[model samples]
Target: MTTALRTDRYELTMLEAALRSGRAGRDCVFEVFGRRLPGGRRYGVLAGTGRVLDAITAFRFGQAELDWLADERVVDDATLAYLADYRFTGQVEGYREGEVYMPGSPLLTVRGTFAEAVLLETVVLSVLNYDSAVATAAARMVSAAEGHPIAEMGSRRTGEHAAVAAARAAYIAGFSATSNLEAGRTWGIPTMGTAAHAFTLLHDSEEEAFRAQVAALGVGTTLLVDTYDVRQGVETAVRVAGPQLGGVRLDSGDLPTLVRETRAQLDALGATGTRITVTSDLDEHAIAALRGTPVDAFGVGTSVVTGAGAPASGFVYKLVARRDGTGADGGAWKPVAKNSVGKRSVGGAKRAERLLRDGVAVAERVVVDDDGDGIPERDAADAARAEGLTARPLTATLMRDGEPDPQWLGPEGVRAARAHCAAAVGELPAAALRLSPGDPALPLVTA
Candidate 1:
């Protein structure tokens, strides 16, 4: 499907204005970064770069879209012609998906003509902000779980499409599986779901429901045991599925107490091997509170898909550098920035690397190139060596000349991102894993 209309009107209007003013073809560099970590987050996990690439690829103005825009008089004929041929034949560089980021990290950089690049601001920010928020929240939950697997069951708590995206993002940030089937099919994420409360209520009794589920899904299926009475349901489940029942889900009540009681009951009933999974409106805090309990897994919904408490990762895309003159290839780059009160921006194309000591991340080093030429690999390495620390280059070439790097695209890309997230989070200082509100785990050092 065409994603051209998934943008704000101002993008096209600005494109039209720039085209008429003869500045649309000017070379431009746009960078995406966050001013501050939302909700005092220690770090932000980068997600949705693959989705952004897909969106950019599908950002075509088909006949239907052009017809609607013309009918609404959204732009003039000249702009419509431009839209008909709108392909982002540009270079895109950014931090790899699932990487941890701090303020001023320069998460994404788009280098293209003014017209092509300006039209991408809204779509780029929309994907990065929402996906990164879910990923950051999921990472926190993963840390709080302290090794228990988390299932993304928030499909019902968010928009249908957003639910799929959230599932993908959560998995990239260490979630074990998702209840969203589309996410599984699209991104190769593991899919998991047993049954909801309604399924239990559909039968003549809880015993009937347990029997039906076990018969269909085997004794290994997780039975919802909190449907009516927690203890009675467990007793009935054990009677039906026997001691070999795979697991029981507690979706309502005091989880810590209930989990302990359920474990004891299962042990007494000779179902000692049965695991306990909790799903009662759990957030990171709630999961942390159950640290020493017998809970085996977590099914997160509202708190995860909605980004815990911060739904958007306050990221902004700004034109940091452009050609000094209107000519596309005739002028040196001139840095540009906004100094509007508290909304100030840094004005240059940048290179970022993580400073590491003994495998622990110490700081984020951002080098601004005012001349618009990116930092060379040897120079970056030399600077890091001079600082007496190992440097890990954070940015990578995501796209070149309009073609996305397949390594960061498809199901394999998701798997790669998931592994990268694990490594990235592991490299942070031990204090970074704490759930308390505090400053970012690493300070930003700009050069």
Candidate 2:
């Protein structure tokens, strides 16, 4: 489906005004960034870059979209004609998905004509904000789990389509698997889960239910054991599925205490190898509290998909630079910004690099007033060297002249992103994983 109509009315009005004023073809640069991390998070994860490129590729006003706009009188004939044949012949550079970001980090930069670049603000922000929020929260949960596997099972807790996106984001941020089958089919994330409490309750007896599940799904199926008495339920599960029962899920009670007792019971019943998975509104803090518990894995719902306490990433897209009269006036790309109270934004075509000292990331350096391409000038790197640091470029060209770069597409992209996230998180100082509220781990340096 064309994504042209998934925009606000004012966008078209602004385009019409610009077209009439003869500024539609002016060279422009727009940037996406977050002013501050929500909940004082140490870092934010970049996600949905691939999705943004896909949206841009599909952002066309087909005949149906043009027809609706004409019937609604949303624009003049000239504007409608322009919309009918629109393509984002643009340059886009941004952090790859799963990279870590800090406050004031220029996450995405789009360069094209004002009309082409300006029309994409809403959809771009929409995809990045939601996906990054879920990935960031899920990454923290993974870190807190201390290497225990986690399954994204929050599909029922969010909108149907959003659930799929959330699952994909969570997987990129180190989730072991997801319960959303669509996410598995679309993104190639491992799909898990065989039953819920409803499955056990549906049968007249728990034994009957367990036997039927084991018979169909094999003796190696995870059984929901907390529907009634967890102790009795575990006993029945091991009895029906034998000591080789794969796993059991605890959905209620104090997780630490229940997991401890359940593990002992399972061991006593000669089901020592049977794993114990817990899922009761688990979040990062809750997961951290279960450290050293007998729990084998986690099935998280609600918190991860909802981004824990901070749902949206609070990203803002703003005009950063523009050239006058499409180079006809010979005006250079002048920087622009907003100085509004409590909501100011940085201006200029900027390039970002993270400073590394002895293989550890120390600070983020942002260079302003360089060429439109995201490359640091010699002076920027020289200044960092003077400070005994090495510079690592943060942005890559993900799109060029209306086509995807092909490196950030499909299942291979997801796997690469997941690996990058793991490495990025690992490179942070030991304090990066601290759950306490604090400032960003790496300070920002603007040159």
Candidate 3:
């Protein structure tokens, strides 16, 4: 489907004004960055780059969309004509997907004509903000799990399309699987789900339900065992599925005490191998609190999908630089910025690299390039050498002249992102993984 209409009206209005003012074709550079990490988050995970690329590719103003816009009188005929033939033949570079970001880090950069690039602000922020929020939260949850697996099961708690996106983001942040089938089909994330309490309530009794589930899904499937009584449910599940039952889910209860008791009961019943999966509005903090418990895995719903209280990543897309003149060939690039109190943005097109010492990330270096010439890795390395540090380039070419790099587009991209997230988070200091409120793990340095 065309993603053109997934934008704000003001974008088109600005385009119309720029077109009339003869400045629409001026070269421009827009950037995406966050002023601060949300909720005192130590770092933010970058997700949805693939989705943004796909959206940009599909940003077409088809006949239907044009008709709707005309009917609503959203723009003049000239603007509609421009939209009909609109194509973003732009250059996009940004931090690689799964990379951790800090305040003032340039997460994305778009270089194109003013008309072509200005229209992308809404869709870009829409995908990046939400997906990054979920990913950052999921990364924390993964850290809190202490190596235990987490499954995304919040499909019922969010918008239909957002559910799939959340699942993909969660997977990119190291989630083991998802309950959303569409996410599995679209992103190739592993799909996992057993039965809810309704399945147990559907049968005449919990035993019949357990038997039905076992008969259908086999003894290896997890059974929800807290429908009626936690103890009785566990006994019935073990008795019905035998000692080979794969796992039991405790959806409600005091998780720490219940998990311990459940583990002991399973051991006494000779179901010592039965695992205990816990679910019930679990966030990273709750998962961390259960570190000493016998919980085997986590099924995160509301918290992970909703970003555990910080639903938006607070990222903003702004025109950081533009041609110095209104001519088509124009003069040198001029940096632009908003200096509003508490919402100031640094000007100039920027490149970023991580400074590492002894394999641990110490700071993020942002290089402002007023000439619009990007920094090469060799130069970054040379600069880092002067300071007795190693520089790791964080930005990559996401798209060139509107065509996205294939490596960062499909299921393979998600897998690569998961691996990258693991390594990137591993490079941070141990304090970065803490759940307490504190400063960002790495400081930001501007050049």
Candidate 4:
């Protein structure tokens, strides 16, 4: 299926106007960035870069898209013919998936003719906004878990398709597994699930349910132990599966207190090896509070998929620079920007790098009209005579012409991104991991 129609009407109108003005072929530079992190988040994890590349590859206009546009008469025949052959022959470079970003960080830059690039605005932002938001929230939960594994179980709380994407994003942010099977199949994410409370309630008795589950899935399968009395449920589960029971899940009540008592009971009952997983309204805060408990893992739902309260990453795509004309002057690009009252934009193409000091990230630096050179690369103290801080490049070539870089395009790409996310988070300052409100972990410097 082509994604050409997943664009705003105004984009086509603007394309028509540009075509009529005879400037549709002019080269342009469009950038995607967030003015600020939502809720003062210390840093934002870049997710969905691979998805955006995939969407770009599929942004073709076949007969169906052209026929629909023709019937709607959204543009003239000239524009219709243009749409008939539309494809994004552009160069895209930005932060790699799993990289950490901050306010004013240019997450993506698209360079192509105006007509080819303008139509991609909506779909690109849509992917980045939702996926990045979910990934950021999931990263917080992962941080709060303090090494305990977390599983994405929010598939029922969101749209069917979004659930799969959410699971992929969560896995990129350090989540160990997902409950969404599609994510496992599509992105190679680990999938895990146990019997829900309904499974226990469906059987004639809790013992029957446990016996059935054990007999079918083996004693290694996790069993729900909170449908009726949690204590009795645990006891019955241990009795049925014996000390070899894989795990028992707690779904309701005081998690910390219940987890402690349950662990003690399991130990006393000689089921000491049985794990204790918790799963009821688990968010970053709730997960943090349970750090001291004997909980084995967590199954999070609504919060992770819904971005834990901030549903959008608040990204905006804007034309930061473009050639002024098709004549000789066109070869020279001019920076463009919107000076609207409240919503202003920064002009010019940019390059970004992170400044490191003593192996820790300390600042983010952006250079305007840079030729991708002069980035610092040593400890700040040792480079006092130079730029004073080591600069690590953040952006990489994502696409050339219309072809996505093979490195960031499949299940293996998702795994690489997940590793990058872990390394990026590990480089941040200690304060960056605090669950409380604070300023951005690293200051942004525009050079």
lDDT leader: 3
Which is the winner by lDDT between candidate 3 and candidate 4? 3
Clashing pairs in 2: none
Q: Model 4 Cα displacement at 277 (Å)?
A: 0.6
lDDT of 1 by residue, 47-90 (tens): 99999998888889999999999999999999999999999999
List pairs with backbone clashes in candidate 3: none
lDDT score of model 2? Answer: 0.90
What is the Å distance of residue 311 in model 1 from its true position?
Answer: 0.7
lDDT of 4 by residue, 255-325 (tens): 99999999999999999999999999999999999988999999999999999998899999998888867
Task: Give each model a TM-score.
Answer: 0.98, 0.97, 0.98, 0.96
Candidate 3's residue-wise lDDT over 1-447, tens digit each?
999999999999999999899999888999999999999989999999999999999999999999999999999999999999999999999999999999889999999999999999999999999999999999999999999999999999999999999999999999999999999999999999989988988999999999999999999999999999999999999999999999999999899999999999999999999999999999999999899998999999999889989999999999999997766568888899999999999888899999999999999999888787665334889889899999999999999999999999899999999899999999999999999888999999988
Q: Which residue segments of model 2 deviate by more than 4 Å?
A: 327-330, 370-373, 379-383
Which residue pairs of candidate 4 clash? 376-391
How far in Å is the alpha carbon of 18 misplaced in model 2? 0.2
lDDT of 3: 0.94
- Give a tens-digit lDDT track for model 2, residues 17-115: 999999989888899999999998898888888788889999999998999999999999999999998999989988888999999998999999999
lDDT of each: 0.93, 0.90, 0.94, 0.89
